[model samples]
Target chain A: MIEPGSFRDPTSRVFYDAGRVFRGLSHEAAEVDAEVRSSGLMNDLVSRGLFVDNWIVNDVTPPSGVSSVSVIESERVPLVTYPAEWPFSILKDAALATLDANLISLERGFILKDASAFNAVLRGVTPVIIDVTSIERFGERGIWTAYGQFCDHFLAPLMLEAYAGIPIHRTLRSRTDGFPIGDLGRLLRGRSGFRKGVLSHVRIRNFFENRAAGMETSERRDVGKATLARPAIVASIQKMRGLVGSLESCAPSTWADYESALPYEESSIDEKDRFVSEAAVKAGAKGLAVDVGANVGRFTGILAEHFDLVVGMDNDPGAADGLYDTVRRSDFTNVTPLVVDMTNPTEAFGWRGKERAALSDRLHPDFATWLAVVHHLCLGIGIPLDEVVEQIFDFCGESVVEFVAADDPMAQRISATRSTDLAPYGVEEFEEYVARRGVVLNKKPVSDTRTLYHLKGR
Target chain B: MTDPLFAYIDPGAGATLAQLALAGTAGLAAIGKLRMNKIKNRLTGKVSVDSESEPDVPSDESAATE
Candidate 1:
């Protein structure tokens, strides 16, 4: 069964059961029902290849007391994917889909009552509008009726990623409803500088946003009954999309600085890849595989050899994007990349309640890998080795994790910070901590310092 | 190959759009009625999705287990 996403707008969210999809629209949105029908928008869109997202008057009635106002129903989608799992191009398409949906709604004599990235979802690689009932009539609209919302969701995140090379939306884990304009403005402050469009859309606008911090929740503010005079609204969204397309990361990273600092010899890197791949095939894992600290998914590709699907999780935005690009370009549909610090994994989507959803609440992988990642977690991130063991056991049944002994070049470099506390961290301590939780059967020394533990649950 | 388009793009929106247009026009027929009590009509029949009424929603315990 498909679970409902956190799309809790006042309007109805579509639900699909068995084989049919349904949306539940209330009287508020149904006010323009007649006008919408007369405008032939539904018909026009149907003819122009719009999906049958919302159903017409169907067999299932809107519960007993929904008579005074109409509660129209619509079709539901099969599955819902969160924005965090989406690739760069997928987000771009969602942005375009939202703008397109808004334009289409105007042509049919209706205006989008609300706009949020959550309103769109990915079907295959395309973004589709999930809530058709969100459209409502409010008389003639202005040139940019949806300008503010577009700014909040699509435009803001896209601009930040393009110009600053930072996936700003990842910050949503802290502040929901996309990024708060205030925080985004603050994040932009320390940034080096910006291009022209960034100046108009974010930098300058932020000065004005700072003027009114807690005046009112942006969602609840009264936008008035101004309709987006169809053309104006469509033109507005289109212009925003065009504006988005114009922004681009100027060039790749300065390869000289990072690339030249080659810590590992080519043979050593190859040996690590071969070691992870060999262990996974030996383990006979068949379902999902997860790679912790999957920088650019190098080991994810290796571990992927033993599973149907692989998830490469990393905290760095650049790492996730790089991994996603590699997977996409290679047509490796089996791999899914996400931005998540192992120390601060997504506890939950926070839909029903803010319970700490065990990491497996979303994915249940059979096997896992931790190649060259343990050092970052133990020494760099400061998560206790014991808790790290528990988190790993929570997600995988059997796994191969490489422990970068404190003396390993990487670990030593990570802990080079004089302030770090690595007194309680060591391969012996990790082995003992994980052994109490699971069977640490073998400790095969991969090198003079690091050791690979073959772990299995009780 | 993954579709170059975003995954959420619906294949059946055309049919739904047609039905919405038809229903929209039907509702417009009562525009005069809508105006006289539009405010009241708009707020009417809002389904307050209270926890008790949300039967399909699963509890945390239920979600964790199979």
Candidate 2:
């Protein structure tokens, strides 16, 4: 089937046949593809792991009615995630990778025509550009056409996080096209609007944009006549690199220190680990495993040892960023960290909501660890226990769920803020709901107030 | 045939102008250097390399208009 998200680029379309990913290029795009390949740039980028690995499929037929003169097959990414599901570091790394690829392409007499963050996919910890068709022969126009997009998609969001201390994932969820500069200008109007990169890329650009909006068509066209040399263009991108590289998230993570502050004794913590490991063994050591509330990835690291690929997911941006740092520092090639709020998980977005698949639809894990997350989903978010059990089971074949009693210190702390009585948040009621939806294979108590159940959906 | 240099997203005219403006004095220096090279080449009866090699393609904004 034709990939719905691939429709924006008319010259090329992505389609999946059987299990492999393929791209059908139009006659013009095919010519450009041939040039890209012949120039040796494709091989160079692929070898560097900066671009997705793909090869020409000579004998294969293009999908029906999809215009193509040539077909190429690409290595499919294990899981596809959007910017809204990425932490600050992940987004920053993606932005750097995009710039690296663009700069390298420019050296080879080619350029990335667009700099959308969607073009870059996180392959484990590494960001690789998957949209090969975005690379095209550099025209005589020396100005980088993708500069505005780069700023809108990468710079603006990063600035918001770095300067305004705002988490951008939720904002990106709504503004799929990236934040508008006009709105960004007003949002960062005070001291932040005058910051180094923000001053030039945001404030000045906003001024020129507003001015251009008021100009006549002919006068607007005259603005395009102003050009820069290739060296000057390179300098501009290098400047962006310096600014983007220096940006760091200033927002504090709520759950970054959750594990440290846990009220559990050392023995209880060790017992919880032992239970999770035993559950992982029972689930079998293969395929994908997702740690639903993998804050700082303590259990995610253990799951990574058994499963071929482990996706560490957490709602807290700081915690997710910490998990990403762990993955990079330890060189865990099989672990992918994502910022996902289990309550309001990433939904099907883009055109008709079919362009990008929902997060749950994309992950089909063999096993899952829903530890320390149930209480938050239940008492914190007010999602019923039955609904929570069903939603957790929906993502994996089997899972180990930790039930934190309402009277537990953490649960009470969570419940203290709310006025509603959480009477049904007992171990007995949770087991009943779990048994209703699926079978409980084994049950182990970590402490007087917390218990772990190995469960499989019917 | 469709223009092969088509940009999927419209690179705003304001952005293009803004980039030039951001280039500031350095951009002016580069333009000046190119003009000087052309003048020097003419004085020495040498062919200008950039003039010969530059492709006759429309800028991104101009192409968007088309």
Candidate 3:
């Protein structure tokens, strides 16, 4: 049951068996464990919800070829999301959490050995460090070893998103290992390069890398031996925290105001929520939902109330960003909004293309709720109604979808330019298509032209 | 003596290059000084764990010795 991505650290490996996360530590890491236990830092952080708690499980024998001094187990995370799938605020929170961990480590005479963004996973809105083995005693703080990895994994991608207007997930998915400073510098040539933090962390670092490439091996080796004071390294960490902390998504707020812009009458909104909730109960949705195209997350919020976990995905970063802010401010721990264009879903990336699983693979939901996105997919994106139904079924076996008739004002507005030859488009056509492939649990008309249907895969 | 608690990470050439740019010549010189201290400690039979103390004098060493 060895987890595939847990091999990076030679000191420890994570295993999943019987629905539990077990960590096996090598003999070498025993002393580190002792030190960690003694420092009380781990306990303190865990108490604060910054890290997952692990308990020694002495009775369990580890797998072959592993000589573990200690075997500890924790509750397995149901969905492990990569940094690439996170929205702006989620990534920002993770970066701050990492820096906060480092600050706490500094006080305890230690630091994070690895600053990979993959080490942290969100528990609701809180970022928790899942890898306990990443902590190590800071001996000669002359060099912050994880600095490059941190900047590449967290800072660079963030700056690209905030300044260069590149989506964080897109940049991260392409460069799974980490964003290389050389390419980062090139992308950030003019206005972004002149920014304060960008100049040193990206541009200057690139300059040094280019300069080193020209020098002899001995010269480069000489440079490798260079060191900075411990205080300087700490200062650098502090400065970076400030830089990453200051970054805010400049994505337009047009979609943030989408809720007010909707033409749905108050009664129609109530009817939609009531129908979805009733369908959710009948579906026996114990806890997971994927709300596609969750503009301003109105339906997502309704879904969040019924489900333990709800991912509100929208193509507009502005809409997702607004939802994230709303979720953070409220007590809605189950809801998370991420920018995902349903047309081009996230694919499996990295080593062997298995490092980060595809978005579809990671999402195992009890139900999928497509409120108003079907019309957008069909009329807006020109995908056929049958194809849209197939995509919905592909997401989850049980679904509650709304059918916006071709004559609906919204649908008319969306396909105004296209031919009215929606030859195979109508409520009757949708019912016929689903009847051949699935069972229609219920169908209720919410408006003159809008109808909601609850369907289960055959 | 290598403390099992301490791990070695090859920070790679890119990181070293960044360190040089950030810290200049003074920083470069400190590396040699630190390396010389390592040699000096080896010759003098002194084990320096960190800037804070001698390796032989672990925080709980006196308790163990007694």
Candidate 4:
């Protein structure tokens, strides 16, 4: 299917046939295509791992059903993750990658016409530009065309996440285009108003936008030529590299201390890991495996060994960032870490709310493992067990999860201050929910109070 | 209502340039730092600072498997 998110770019459209991903260039993009091909810079960038590798499909005839002047097959990104879902460091890396691409493109007589965050995807931990068609011939436009987009898509969100402690991913759920500059200006403290980057990018931009809003189009046009010379634009790109490179570290969340606050004995943890690995191997999972509530990726590392891609998702931004660091350092090429809350996941947003797919729809895993988090979801958050199971089954073919007995220490502690309505919240009630939608393949009592079950959708 | 010659610079670009103009020497300092890094890399025969080995991104902390 031609992805809904791939429709905004008119120069090219991405399509998936069977299991492979391909891009079809419109006749209008023929010149850009030829320029990219003749230069061989795309291939060079691909070799250096800066650009996602794409090959011109010479042997095939545009896959017969597809129509275009030229067709190229791109290596399928294991998971199509968005910038909103990225950690501070990952977002910084993407910004650097964009500037790096611009610098390299300039060297090769081209420039990236689009700097949207959606154009880049994380393969493992490294950010690679996926949209090859965005590259265009560089000329004397005398302005950095993508400067504003770079700020909205990269700078604004990173600053908020870094300085204000607001999660960029959550903010992006409302508006995928970018965090509005005016909103950012207001959100940051008044003290930050004096900072140069903030002064120029946020405060001044808001000033101009507000002033422009009140002025007639003709009057606004009367403003002096803001076109930047080549050297100035080049300097701007270099300055952006420095700004992106120095983003402050994200503050730690409660889950950041999860490793030290872990309640389980080490032997019990090992047992749980063994149970999870054996269940995955028995189920023959190979597509995507997600560890929902994967605090710091303790179990995601095991899931990565079996699945083509493993997404470690958690609500805590700090935990997700920690997991990203862990996965990036390891030899595992199949794992990605993202900040996502299962209760309130990311929805489809962007142009007409279809430019970027919803988190549940886009990262639909073949199997999902929810470890030591069901109690927190049920007792701590008050979401019904049946609803949680149904939601989990809605996105995956099979699910492996654990249920904590209501009287367990962790469950009790979480629900301690709540009402005494604990009669209906038990392992039996949880199993009944699973049976309604799927078949239970195996169930193991991992501990005195915790039970693990592997189930397949009916 | 876009400028025909500078059609690429949208309102967002205007905002960015607004910020860059006000940033003053901060931008210049950044550019100078970049030039020094480039020269250092050139002298040491090191690959460009954009490589995966950049020290700006902290090294991965060991995963707690236990």
Candidate 5:
């Protein structure tokens, strides 16, 4: 079946057949592919681990109506995440990687036709460009055509995060095409409007965009003739890289230091780790394992040892960013960190809400660790214990859930902020919900107020 | 097979035109900076080769057309 998201580009179409991913290129796209391959650029990108590994497959039959076809098979990304689900640092890194890829392509007499953030997928902490067909020969149009897209898809959102303290991940959820330049321009119209990149990248670009929009087709074509020298184009891209590199997320740090300030005793932390590890091993952790509420990835590190692939998810941008930094620094090749709130996860969106699959549909982990997360969903978010249990079972077959009693310091701290009484939140209520939805294989008391349960979905 | 261009996403005409203008400005600024550095080196009695003075290599403009 043709990949729903791969229909926009007519020259190439991505399809899956019998668990294998394939890209069927038209005769025209094949010629471009041959040129790029012959130029040795593809091998260079693949060797550097910057591009997805794909090889020509001659055995696969082409789809009907095409005169001829060149089929390429690709290594599928374990989990496909959109830019909206990434933390600030992850998105920043992806933007830099895209620019680097484009710069490298320019050196090889080619350029990326589109600068869409969707073209890149995070494998572990590294972002790899998956849209091989986006590369094409650098045409005589001496200006980079995808400049507007880069500004829209990367620069605008990043600037908002850096300047206005707005989290791009949340903003990007609805604006898949990246933030509109005009809207960004108006939003940053105060002091931030005069910030370094804001004036040129957002305001000036938006002005030109509006002007071009109002022009006649003939007038616009005349303006399109405006060109620059190759060196100048390269310099502009380099300047963009410098500007993007300088941006730092100004979003207030939350849960970034959660591990440092544990509400429970230090021994309890180690005890919880042991319990989670034992549960994972008992469940035969070989497939994907997710560390939900993985603030700074204390338990994600443990799951990484047993599972083939581990995903560390946290709603806090700072926590997810911290996890990404730790994973990259430690060179953990199997863990993918995501910024996701369990209570309000990413929903299905895009063309007919079918182009991009929702988070729950994509993640079917063999094992999951919901350490210190249930109380936040139930007491903090006011979600019922049964509903939280059902959501957990929906994502994984088996999980290690940590139950924090309402009297616990952290739970009290969460409940104190709410006007609603959470006095009924106790061990009995949790176990009843678990019994209704699944079976608890084992239980261990990590602390006076916290207990770990190894649960299997019915 | 005949169509050489497959630019599916519309590269905004205004943005493209603005990029050309911006690149030109950036190029001029770089040249100015290079000239100032060259002058500074001369005053400081540091002999340095001015690579910017070299002739430009001809580019392959005919390689591909949109």
Candidate 6:
């Protein structure tokens, strides 16, 4: 019996048991896989180690196409990640790898049928292309079926990071399927924007996209090349790579707010870091977490030890930039940073339909750190304490959070510009709020105005 | 006799944890539980607990209190 799964790629179905894996395909899909294999694309990818464990020959004849297609039994990989979880550098690397894969696919007589970032998943620092089904033979009139997808998945996000000084963090968490066209288009179409390729690649698609909004339900599909001339596809892919780089090199971070604001004073920062490290170890959390107002990831960096993983999430590019820069400079295996607007967090969404992984879903029962974060969400962002508790309890098992006073200078700065709809942040109120939701550990005073509360879900 | 293991791979960060101890005599069943629950949750998006963070007793502190 086969337990079929994986919804992103409609054509291929993944199955596994006893350390073995199988891929079920309809007759046509198997034929396509065979074509990809016989055409030598599979061998090329295997040779380059671009793929994870590979297809093992099998005899489960599928029921589509000209003839029955047999299942391609394969080895099961240990992990499957979506783009939303990746830090900026990892996403960039995935895009570069995808471009490289496209180039390689052309060399091996195939084209990446879908250059969507979802085709890749990270295993540590290495970015491996996971979706074998997203390939087809190269042809002269090859349409970038994944073109619109790539724009949403890779190009748009990259450009946002490059030009607008927004880290692609929101794109990752909010758009696991791919960044929504409307949002990316809005970002790219900002006032005085649409410079060069942005107009061509993004605006053009946005036009067709708005046009295609609801005219047709969908259309019948096929397995073969949309077009099969090698030269044209290769040229287009090359142009795409150039465009991607320009998107990457658009502009670096230039936010004065980041320059002016201090995430943490030197002494407070170090002590906070040490405190987090000790807590994460004590909690036996497989991972440590920092809410994005994470500033520079100092707490996450310090807690990176002892815990198997550390996640630094912050909404600001200037802040995420610092986090990403640290991850890039170090060999810290466990640390990751994401862009999160905590006031409106990214919700869980699926690959195909609603029956897949959401942004917050995870296999690990976790331990987390929400340091220096609640105040920004509370005083600055206007999220309620109860909702904050709910978000944490949903994602983590045990968590530690900092309750910064409304009068704190840092709190004042974060809220000075924004409308603080919520009442002023208070330690007593926060303690009571936490207690109602779960068992609140004793408070550890990080400062007169800033204190950390350890928590366990009741 | 056979053994199994528990692996939690966070999709966003790609930070995964594998508990080798979960494969031993003490953990063999725990491994089975992990695998079982993982499959259930993977195919079906079920957050193990809802109202998980809801306070045991209602709190006066809220958005108004911040």
Q: Pick by TM-score: which candidate is best? A: 2
List fnat per candidate, in order. 0.00, 0.38, 0.22, 0.17, 0.39, 0.00
Worst 10 residues of 5 chain A by lDDT: A214-223
- Model 5 alpha-carbon drift over 4 Å, by segment: A62-68, A139-141, A420-424, B1-4, B25-66
lDDT of 3 by residue, A1-458 (tens): 77766767767878777777888888767677778778898887788777788767898877775557988787566677778777878888888888888877777777787788988887865678888777877755446667788888888888888888887767887456667877888898777778768877887676556544433333334444555655666677787889899998764554678789776899999999899889888988677888888877888888888888888888887787788888888889888777788898888777777766788888888898898888988998889999888888877999999999888898888899998666488888898888877989999998898999999998
Ranking by lDDT: 2, 5, 3, 4, 6, 1
- Report i-RMS for every model: 16.5, 10.0, 11.8, 18.2, 12.8, 22.3
Write down the lDDT of every candidate, Cα atoms only: 0.56, 0.81, 0.76, 0.73, 0.80, 0.57
| Candidate 4 C-alpha lDDT tens digits along A9-83 | 655778887788888777656667787778987877788777899888854444434457888888888788888
lDDT of 4 by residue, B1-66 (tens): 112332433534245336345445643343233333332333234544343244233221111111
Candidate 4 structure lDDT: 0.73
| Candidate 2 ranges beyond 4 A from true positions | A139-141, B1-4, B26-66
DockQ of each: 0.02, 0.18, 0.11, 0.07, 0.16, 0.01
lDDT of candidate 2 over B1-66, digit per residue (tens): 113355666777668766876786855553344333333343244544644353233443363365
lDDT of 1 by residue, A176-275 (tens): 3565544555656544345545555565455434322211221112112112244444554566668766665332332113323646677666667676
Candidate 2 RMSD to the real structure: 7.4
Chain B TM-score, candidates in order = 0.21, 0.30, 0.27, 0.24, 0.29, 0.21
TM-score of each: 0.65, 0.90, 0.87, 0.84, 0.89, 0.67
Worst 10 residues of 6 chain A by lDDT: A216-225
Q: Write candidate 6's Cα lDDT for A1-458 as tens digits.
A: 23322544445666554556666665556666787788777878766757655774655553332123456654444344556555556677778778777788777666675666766765534567877766665543433445555666887777776777665665566455566656766776556265656655566555534432221111001111113245544655577677776554333543314524665567776677666667777787464354445667666667666666555666555566567777768888666666555565555465344433544543343667777677766666687766776776766768777778887888887788876566635777776777777887656776677887778888
At residue A422, candidate 3 shows an lDDT of 62
Candidate 1 vs candidate 3, DockQ winner: 3
